[model samples]
Target: MDDVVRRTALPGRSQSPHDKLARGLGYFSIALGVAEMVAPKAICKAAGVEGIENVVRGYGAREIATGAAILTSHNPEPWIWTRVAGDLADIATIATGLRQDNNSKGRSALTLAALAAVTIVDLACANGLNSEKASRKTAARDYSGRSGFPQGLQAARGAARDFKVPDDMRTPELLRPWT
Candidate 1:
């Protein structure tokens, strides 16, 4: 996008396809995390990955945290980047399973492909968010001629010197420190 168009007023940049994508991905992460955490054994069996329930659960926790941050933050850019980082970690972990001797090699490959797809989406979303610009221009007004006090500084300083405290606002006699 051109710099001029990017630097538009607030409403113009409020909603975009990238924002919706980010939100969708957030919900997807939470759902996937829940399933992974709740049924690690089932996931492992389905994914053909065995004996890694604990690792799966840990990744699930990471996913949930990343998703929550993405959903709750005013700016989800950093959270999305976190997701990208997590994706890389997941890819690395799954790649180890791609060894020829691994019984679940086929499933692992499939999972890696899916992860790659999601990572692409994450990268695109992160890039979109990074490029988004805010062009809100503050109005320039001259306040130099005005003073908070109507009188000059010296007179204003003592203007409230004789002011009396209202009974309602004063400390109770019982709690007073001095007679």
Candidate 2:
């Protein structure tokens, strides 16, 4: 006799269903913005210096809004979040300048501006912020990695071996006293 076996697929390999949904929505909005930006008439209207200014303002506003939101979040990784927000805000301002009054100069600045925007957006979408417990653990790990941290003290934690009192007799004292 022969027997048949069946297996079911497991989730969480690439992305959770929720993450996929969010990404799809985000991409869709971006597509719409691109379409608007590239429209023939829209391009003509915003082609010269004046149009670039408008584009810069629009992008800057978006960055400011997003940065504010991130900064205000109660996430445990507040430091990282704040940094990300500040970076975004900086990029937005640079991008505005890159748009330029006459659309001239600032090639390198424009490149950096785009990079900043992409990084900030990626962070926002990834939801990479950690919880309070995780943040604290990470902080502790970083702190312990510091130099001049007295390895002798850390090693003497349990046994109190290396932490014994000096051999010189002062008052009566116990070496390696137990807690």
Writing each residue's lDDT as its tens digit, candidate 1 over 1-179 gives: 34333333343234667777888889988998998899998887766677889999999999998899888875677999999999999888777777647678889889889999999999999988777633223212334545677675666776677998867566776787774
With a 3 Å backbone cut-off (N, CA, C), the pairs that clash in candidate 1 are: none
Judged by whole-model lDDT over C-alpha atoms, candidate 2 comes out at 0.43
lDDT for residue 86 in candidate 1, whole number 0-100: 93
Clashes of each: 0, 0
Choose the strongest candidate by TM-score. Answer: 1
RMSD of each: 13.4, 17.3
For residue 150, model 2's alpha carbon misses the true position, in angstroms, by: 45
Q: Best-fitting candidate, measured by lDDT?
A: 1
